[model samples]
Target: MHVLCTAGHVDHGKSTLVRALTGMEPDRYAEEHRRGMTLDLGFAWTTLPGPGAVAFVDVPGHERFVSTMLAGAGPVPAALFVVAADEGWMPQSAEHADALAAAGLRHGLLVISRADLLDPELARDDARAELAARGLGSWPAVAVSGRTGEGLDALRTAIAELVAGLPAPDPDAAVRMWVDRAFTVRGSGTVVTGTLGTGTVHRGQELELDGAGGRIAVTVRAVQELGEPVETATGVARVALNLRGLPREKVRRGDALLDPHAWPSVVEADVRLHGIGGPAQVPDSPVGLTLHAGSAAVPVRVRPLGDDVVRLRPDRPLPLRIGDRAVLRDPGAHRVVAGLTVLDPQPPALRRRGAARRRAGTLAAASGVPDAAGELSRRGAVRTGDLVRWGVPGPEVAALAARVPTAAGWLLDPTRATEAAEALDRAVAAHDAADPLDPGIPLAEARRAAGLPDVALVAVALDRAGDGAPGGPVVRDGRVVRAGDDGPPAAVLDAARQLHADLTAAPFAAPDADRLAALGLGPRELAALERAGELLRLTPDVALLPDAPDRAVEVLRGLGPEFTLSAARQALGTSRRVAVPLLELLGRRGRTLRTPEGTHRLR
Candidate 1:
């Protein structure tokens, strides 16, 4: 299926051309028929010989309704640009032509309508010249009379040929259908109609509706195409979705139904305007304009970056991507101000005084194409999925495997990898200097020190630093450790050795707080010795050898299976304070069990 929108001046017979081709009325409102002019968007479709089904979105062409015309034409890929023979080229014709060019529409058929009223050959030549001036000279022209049906067959054939040659859209792409017509059906609830440009929509598929009120989850209760209910609908086809979990008032004509996880609602972006050698010029900085894209017309504040580049900050968040074409209109003048091609949907902030001017130079050099490596380099690192949402194709992201390194589902720039590795080395050295007893840095702290987003990236930085290199950073257990370094400093180790000697000589003589402090064992040093398996801490102050519990159990077994705390202390030759917690620690280790009466037995 193929969908095309009608564009031309008001009363240029755009709707008439659609009616003649489809044998269906293009105008839906009574006011439109009574006034004999298109006031809003009208929809009709017909089955072509080779194209299967071709849908037409008839848009109003009056200068007042240019916004309405853009809403219809923005999402459709091709167009049926109509111009009456009697009125070869009109004001709305130039505006619509500029709009279509601004929309980046390359596939279309120029229809010279009402040929019976005048000689269409002359009109066709004149219309072709006018279109050429507006950058649409490549489209095929057809002379047809919608009233008398003159040359209708040729027009249909031209449309079929134009649609058959259009670039195929990916049915597997992410869905981002803009709602051109949204209303409530009698019993089906809210129904939104739009031309699906890519991806497929199926019944029961959950989607996110992004609008002025922010994002909300909605389910597709049903899908319909050409007035027939269907299990699924693909791109380049007109679809009417019966949506559940939303009211008619909430779903507006400008809202979009997007794959919930595939789009990011953004408010600011850097863009290349069709400024130089084009019909429109970039407006001055901080000027108010209406940005039209994909059936959405949002008020925006434009900051002129260069002669042809700008940064647009929309009043509301929009689902935008790089390379997407949009129109910027001066709402006060009611005319197109500029046409834009998005360069960066996720632009950096212009905080410094000259940042905007400097950024303009950078954007001028950008290719305005989806570049995974370029984006990754700009951000240093980003989620793989985020690049996809930024308009980089999944295949391109996968192909970046050789150019970019991924850690914890994030793509890391080569330069950033080097920076993070150096950061890791500094962090390890700092941590070791600050606390020699426990030198290895915690993984979370290492991630922060390296300025990496994820803790898992610390390992990647370690690997980048040549993890096992002599004295280089490496991860031991869960902490980031320096390579080739044995335990604590020599002085701390000497103190630990003396403590070990004391504990070995008297197996159960746990050191008191003052004694341990005298031996230079603080909480940190003691915990380090404990982690090294050299000592066991029965309490904050009481210390013992790692095997003291085993030797104590043997001594208690000599006193029979059960013994009182006092008897145990006497047997172990330790004081009551040290004996109390030691007995409790033995029970906790399951080497001994405590009776209800507070006597203990070996387990």
Candidate 2:
């Protein structure tokens, strides 16, 4: 079934034409039947020759109720633009045309009603010019008289051709039906009438209704397509859904039912606006306005992002996506100022200086977000949820499983993963080059250098880096460093010899950090020497040869329970500086303990 809506000036014979063709009254309310003008949405259906079942959404043409017109027209695929023959073009006609154009409506038919009142050809020519100005001139048109049924068959043929050319909606797409009407039946629960944009709705299917306070879970009790009970219904058809768990009064006209997890519920979104032919400048400051997308018309605050980009802060969060189009209107003046293309549904908070300008630059090219491969390449690494949140179709991202790296719900582009791995290897290599005597650089430092978040990301990189841990600079000592710990370099070999000779002369004595640096054997050389088992460094300035600890243990064992610092210095034949630190180390090791009289003794 194909759903189409009528758009024109007030009392332009929209309902009369539909009634004359369908053999059924289009006006449903008593006021509309008495006043002979549509004040709210009216529905009717007919069968076209080639198009089969076609539904008509007759919208209000009165200026006071244009909101009703928009609610009816937003979901329909095509439009029947009605124009009265006597009235060539009116104010409401232009306004209606603007609404259709702002909605990006591409397929339509021009019907010149009341053709008996004036020359039908002249009226058609004027209507054609007006539609051409709005970029809708290519549609099929016909002149008809509802009073005499003149050219009624020709009008049906035009509509059939229009409906035949309409593209079929994606049956598997997520359902986001905007509620145009909600009421309660005596036997049934809450029922909602709307045009299902896409996807299939089945009886007892669960859906989500995003409303004022928060989203409420709703279930479909039964389905009605074209006023008949059905078990299943597809897109491009008018449906009346009997829903459960949602209050009929709380479910307003603009509320929509959508996939809860797939789309974001955000009050603020960055949008790329399409400029309409209006003189209004893009607001530099926050301006109060109304936004129209699908069947939603709600108040919002507009903040300009760039030349044609704006950030809309709606009074209420709505279910929206990245590529959705919307119309912006100044509700006070009731004028269509511009159309918008959603750039990013979720944006960063403007916290730092010049953040807004930088954000504007990111959104300068609103359509620049590339497809699957390009998105992965741009983001470097993304989570599975991020793939959908950033607007990449979930199935397409899933298809890249073999091409990308995935672990624990994280996805990394192959090129980015390789680059990070190579960077980590370089960091390890550099650390090893600087400290030949030390273990690999600390894991923390390597992760920071590679610009990764956690150790798991590094692990994924390392597995693909091809540098095995046993032979490479990436080792585990709490610090990442070169794989091997060789002896000091030849330049520092003399320094090392002096240090060894001095330490051996007095086993408990050691060189300070300055003395080691003077000999060109610094922390790295010391670390290397210790790793090679040539020296034991308990403190920064205290280094003992490998056999020194055993010899000192014996030295302290010979001392009685009471011995002064001077006595130990004399016995060891070392400076007080060396004797003091050595005695402290022995005390810590439990070989001796300090007495109250400033003496050392076996513990």
Candidate 3:
């Protein structure tokens, strides 16, 4: 199955031709029928014996409904361009062609409707010349008159040939079905019709309706193609799914049902805008406009790139991946001013104008190449859809995946990796310059000060930095300590030898910070000493050098296997500051037990 949309001027016989082919009136509303104009979207499907099935999305041709026309044409892969034989060419015709081209519709058939009303040769020549000027010279053109049924069979044959050459849709990729029509059936619950662009939909599969964060566990009660029931539907097929859970009002036209995990709910994108003629000349800062992609329309603030490009910030959070094609329209004039392809769907930061321009240049160059995914992955992970929007052929996307660089399942850019490494090296050098006495800066603090994105990137940088020299100081938690400096501080070393003698003579007590300060050890000195791997400062007033507490524990355990805080204080010859912290540490370590009764016992 193939989905195609019609575009041309109003009263160009678009609806008449659709009615003639499908034998179904496209004008659904009484107002449309009475006014003899298509005010809303009209849809019909036809099945040619040899060509299989094709769906027609007939859009209103008036200039006022250009936005509506865009919404219908945005998702279709091919189109049927209608031209009235008498009119030849017009402004709305050019606008429709420009819109189709901007939305990236490459395959189409030109239908010269009302051919019987004009001289056959003149009409043929005129239509061909008009299409050729729009760069659609190779498109097949056929003449038809809905009133007389003249040339209808020939037009059908031409349409069949055009659709037959189109690439078979990929059902294995992520499912992205754009809803063109939604209605309720009397017996059935709610039926939504759309072109299934990718992936297969089975009878009872749960799929998420994107743009609305809503999940409908649909039991595909029935499937239809060109009005006939079918068992399964694949990509390129126009499908009417009889959904189980959602109501008629709940599901609207333009909603997409996509693979929940494969597609992101909200993506930050980098877009390169092609200025309408050359570039928009704005003396003042650029203003915001609405960007239309697929069935989703979002208001975006445009940040211009000197003269050629612009960055867009969408107002509504949309489920757009990298490589999506969006049209930026001037909401005030309601004219499409530029077309854009998403580069980074989730960018790191929108900072540094110069850096953004450089990145944009790289993306533009990559997008113009034959292997966009490979080029993008060589830089970083790019969404597969982004590669398509960049104009790379679909078959090449999988081939480009092999070229991506991965480390522990995370993709990394070689250039970014190198930059991170250099940044870390600079950080270490800066730290060494500032704190020569310390072994090295703590890894956590180094990571914070270096201002890199992740710890893994920092680790990669450190590994690269240590390639030439002996390894620097070891890092534990957030602390940096020199290797082999696990002994007591020099001041604490002297104090420990005396404190141990004092504790042994008395039995279970230790000195406080004031006592250590009296021996020339202050807070700053103590911090340096701790970084040197010396004494552990248990509290504001309490201190312990290694091995002092261990000996004190043994003396108390041997004395009576249990002791009171008062008795322990008397034994170690210390005051409450040293006695309390020492007992608390022992209790915390489970080496000695402490009770609310103030009794201490060896565990």
Candidate 4:
């Protein structure tokens, strides 16, 4: 189903056009009919030949009800822009035109209503020129007289063609039903009517309803599409939901029923305005303006972030997504002050000194509008929960999660991930060079060196680098490095090899510092060997073979799980300098069960 909204000047025959098309009166209240002006909003639907079912959200054309018009127009992508032939062009026509263009609406039928009252062709030409000036053009134009039924057939055909050509709605997209009307139906509780802009809404579904009061849980007790009860209703259609646990007063015209997981609500956002080049030049001192987004408009304070981007903090949290278009209006002047496209819903706080200027640069770059992954990379890493908060659509984040690795709830950008991987390699190499006789640097230190957002990503970066050829920086066991790095530097290669062989052969006895210094393998060379996993040191003087602990375990197992210190010494054939620590190492590994009396048993 497709939903189209009407736009025109006051008393320009918008409601009359809708009534002619749908054979139902659009004005619901007696006051509206008697006054011949739509004070709120009205809805009517009909079936088109090839496009199936369609609904028309009849919006008020009076300047007094401009906000009501914005509420009706936000969710409906297609429009039936009505202009009375006799009037040609009017004041409200321009305001409505600004609203449509601001919303980025591109599909519709331009109607010359009450054409019998004027020369149809000339009026159409004038209307077309006026619309083009407002940045709206190329829609099929038709002359129609609702009272006389003149040219209604051509109008229908044009509407059908427009709806047929509209981009297909994504049923799997997140549901954001912008409620424009709410009421009570006796025992039915609160019945809210809205345009289901995307995704599908089903009966008995629980969703987050975001409004002035913030988010609250609501259930759809029943759903009606085009006046018929249905289990589900897809986007681009009008839906009335019988809601449970919400008062009619709480379900206001601007409230939104949304997918709790997909549609996150925010009170403030940074946006780039279109048409007028950018949002109205809001000042450092905030000013009140109406912010229109998704069948909702709330009073907001506008502040300029840059020439092209402005920050809007609404009176309440709103369900917003990147690329969603909105209109900013000065109610006093009844003029479209600006038209905005959401750039960042969760903008960085400008609390630090010079943060505003720095963020202005980011906003400038964002105006180029990269895709989801590119934005993520530019930010380095974003908390998974904040993807939508930054105005990225939830569906995009979900798709990205499948493609990228999310470690510890942050989506690591592919480019930044590569940089971090290289950084990790460099940090390990630097540590090994400075402290030659130690294992790899701690994960915390690596994270700090790379300026990583989380320590979890340190391990992830190495895992992604994969195991290298026997002796690369990839030599990681848990958080420690098993120093089998490619090889030590040219200056220490000979000394490093000699130290390794000496430690391997001796297994239990480590050479003294004086002996190490004499061999030209100082503290650094020893640390480097340890990083390469070629040398294992139990103490400053006692370097042991890598397999020494396991060998001790084997001998102790054969000794019937009971042995004294001297007995263990004889088994390993080493003195207490090596035996004591080795025995402790064995006990620590759970290979030997040490009793309170000091006897050791096989664990």
Candidate 5:
């Protein structure tokens, strides 16, 4: 099915043209028919001399209803730009034209309505010239009169030709449908009417209300194209989806229904502003504007980069993919200032202008090549949409992705992959230099030291650095260690000797902190020694020698079951601070089980 929307000045006969072509009234409400003006979106279906159906979204043209017009036009890729023969061009016509251009609608036919009321030749010439001025050149124009039905056949033929030539809609990609009109059906529950961009809406598929963050499990109770029930609707077709598990109030106009996993609700984007006419000498500062994308218009604040680029921050989170074109219009002036294509929607950092530029440069370079994997090796993961914004065609972008390298399903540039591995290696070496006896740097601490972006990348880096070598153990649980460096520190070795001597002399007691301090071991130094796997500081004061055999057996033999905390403190010959940790360590080691009641025997 093919869907097209109508746009023109107020009362320019857009609705009349739709009614004339479809032989159905586009005005749904009695108030609209009586007032002779369309207040809301109207739908009509007409069968052309073709294989599929053509759906028409008759949109309101009044200046006040511009937002409504946007909602209707947002999803449709084709349009019927209507013009009244007598009036030629009006202000609303220009506004609607701008809206269509902003939304990136390029396929359309210019319909000169009320042709019978004016001199046919003059009306045709003037309409042609007027549309031409708006950059709509030589588009098949049909002069039709709703009163007389003159030229209706030609209009139908023109529409049929336009629809037939449209590129086949992609229904298997991510789902995105802009809601032009949403309401409740008596028996159908919540009905949302719009054009589906990509992906099919099956009878029982799950769809997420994107802007609202609401989930709706819909059984395609019915599908309507041009007012008649259809089995399925593809991209570029007007559709009214009867959704289950949702109410009318929940699905509003301008909301989108998309694939939950495929579509991200929040996106960070790098935008290049093309001044409407030419380059503008604009200052580098943040400015608020209205962003029009798909069927949604949102308030966004743009942080400018020099004179031409800006980082756009949408007020409300929006579902956008890489390469989606968005119009940035000055909200106060109500004029479109520029158009932007989304680069990195869901960026890691929004404030770092330098990082954004680096990413953008990488995206730009990757976009220019045929092999994205090769490019990613030099750069990083490029947002699929960003490549499109950089002027790489969709098919080419998809082709390039075949070469993209991935680790555990996450795409990684070869350079970044290499950098991550080197960073991890440097971190391990640094830790070993600082504390030779330490087992390794904690994984979190290693990542921080390496300045890696995420833990997943860090893991990949460590795994690569290890290279599955039997002798090279690059990482241990939460800690990274070099193979040869797991040796005891001098301080830990000295403490270990003292601990063993004390245990030998007083088998039932552990040494106090003063004794460990006397041997030149502090808590910070002890922690470092423990991380080095040199000495186990089982208790604050009770230091266990690394060579101690199953130390838990010694603890249980010495303390026995039902040992009191005071007795353990005295046995350790230290304060509560030292004895508590000692008891806890013994419990952990299964030497003695410490319960809430007190210590117990492991047996």
Candidate 6:
């Protein structure tokens, strides 16, 4: 199904034409029926010959309801612009035309209504010229009379051709249905109607309602399309959703029902602006304005960044994305201010002097299109989900794997990755130079040294450093180390050799604190020797050869199975401090057994 909105001046026969085409009255309210003019948005549908089903959102053409007209036209893809034969064009006609053009409506048809009252050719030519001035001259034109049904068949044929030529919407796109109407039924709790531009809505599906109240969780109790209950409703169709959560009054017209986590709620965005009449039509100061996108009309503060670009700070966070188009209006003048194409939904803060001017220069090159490489490079790094929220479609995000290096759900820029790798190299080199005996820096410390936000990025930088490079960084035992760094420093190894020579001469004579101090064997150096299997530290103060315990066992065996501490110390030529702990270590290792009298027995 295709949905199209009506645009024209008041009393231009927009609703009358919709009623005649669909065989149903579009004016639902009693006041509208009596007044013979649309006061609010109305709905009607019909099946064209080749297009199957088409829906018309009959919007009011009155000047007072201009916001109402924008609300209807924002979500619909095509338009049915009406012009009466007797009245060629009017003030409301120009405003509505500006609205349709500001909305970026590409497919539409010009209908000259009440053709029986005068020659429709004159009205058609004037309408065409007016549309041509607004850059909409290619649309097809038809003459029809709602009262006499003149040229109704040709009008249907023109609509059928227009609907058939529209670009197909992605059924798998993320769901973001802008609510146009909301109410409560006696049986059902709440119901909201919208035009589902893409994606599908099914029964029991969960969606988020984003608006001034912030985002609230909502569930789909049921789905209906064209006044009939359905299991699912696909996009480009008018749908009424039976919601499970929130009261009818809470769900307002500007709220949106969206796929959870699929959109970013932004309070400020940078946009490329296009004025309706000319550059002068857009305000240049930070003046208060209203921004209308989809079914939302929000008050905003504007800051001009360039001649054709501006920054908007909305009163409330909006679920907007890159490449999304919206209309800016001045409520005081009740006029269309400008059209905007979003460039960045999440922009950096302009805190430094001349930042806004520099930002203007940066935004001047933007095409208002979502490019994965460009976005990642601009931010240095970002989460993959953020790209989706910024309006790069899921397929483009998936394609990032081939374009950049991703780690821990983040897409990294190539230059940023290279800089991180260089930082890691500098950190390792600085650490090694400061302490030659230190093996490497801890992973967390390395992450901080590299100025990375996440610890997981440490390994990524190490990998990017290229381990095969000479003396490149590598991870070892939770520490980032230089490649080919296997053992202790050369100075520590030389000290270990001297300690080994001393213990080898008098097997069990452990080194004293004074002797170890002379050899420069500190705790770290001693521990390094212990790791290399060259020394065994009985305690912080006692150190001996690695095989001292075995040699002591053999010596004790020579003195028979049982021996006292004094006897063992005399036999091993060591002090009581070394004898006591060494015996405990032997007993713990099952090499010797201790008696109740504090004697030692070889196992």
Per-residue accuracy of model 3 over 386-414 as CA lDDT, tens digit each: 45544456677656545543333333455
lDDT of 3 at 540: 51
Least accurate stretch of 10 residues (summed lDDT) in model 1? 275-284
Q: Using Cα atoms with residue i matched to residue i, what is each candidate's TM-score against the true structure?
A: 0.90, 0.73, 0.82, 0.75, 0.78, 0.82
Model 6 segments more than 4 A misplaced: 34-36, 277-282, 357-365, 431-453, 465-467, 484-603
Clashes per candidate, residues 3 or more apart or on different chains: 0, 8, 4, 12, 15, 0
Better of 2 and 6 by TM-score: 6
Query: Candidate 1 lDDT, tens digit per residue, 1-603?
Result: 999999895873878888888989989888988888899999999998988899999999889899999999999999988888898888888888878887788788889899999988887888788778767889999999988999999988998899889999999999999999998888889999999999999999999999999999999999999999999999989999999978999988889999997987888999998842354466765766899989999988888887778889999999998889998887787677767888998888899998988988877677779898888877778888888998999988988855666777887877887898888888888878988888788888888888888987777766765746888888778888877868777887899899889888888787777888899988888888776677788876678888887888888888987889889999999998778988888888898887888788888
lDDT of 6 by residue, 1-603 (tens): 999998895862777788889998888899987777788889999988889999999999988899999998999999999998988888888889888888788789999999989999999999999887777889999999988999899999999999989999989889999999999888898999999999999999999999888999989999999999999999989999999967887888988999999999998999998766456344855766789999999989988777777889998999999999999988788788888899999988889988888888887778889987788877777888889888897788899856777789887777777788788888888887887667678989988887676777777756765744757887777888887766687788888889888888987777788888999998888876775576889987688888888888888887787899899999988889888999999999999888898778888
lDDT of 5 by residue, 535-554 (tens): 66665445555644354355
In Å, residue 597's CA in model 5 sits off its true spot by 14
Q: Which stretches of candidate 2 lie above 4 Å from their native place? A: 277-281, 368-370, 377-380, 389-391, 413-603
lDDT of 2 by residue, 1-603 (tens): 999998895772878898888877878888887887898888889888898888999999876777778888887889999999888787878778877877768799999999888887887888788788777889878999988899999999998889889888989877889888889998897999899988889998988888776788889999999889999999988999999766678798888887656667877888877644443357544766778877788888987766777788988998877677677777667666776767767676778877778878876655835256655554566666755755677788788756666766677777777788778778767766775555466677777887765555666666655455555444454655444544456666667788888877767667776778788876767777776677888765567787765676677566676888887777776677777777787788887887787777876
Which pairs, if any, clash in model 2? Answer: 439-481, 440-480, 440-481, 441-479, 441-480, 441-481, 442-479, 442-480
The ten-residue window of minimal lDDT in model 2 covers 276-285
Report, for every candidate in turn, its global Cα lDDT versus the true structure. 0.86, 0.77, 0.67, 0.78, 0.67, 0.86
Cα-lDDT of candidate 4: 0.78
lDDT, candidate 6, at 510? 79
Candidate scoring better on TM-score of 1 and 2: 1
| Pairs of residues clashing in candidate 1 | none
Best by TM-score: 1
Q: Candidate 1 regions off by >4 Å? A: 121-126, 279-282, 303-309, 348-365, 399-404, 434-438, 527-534, 549-564, 583-602
lDDT of model 1, residue 231: 100
lDDT of 5: 0.67
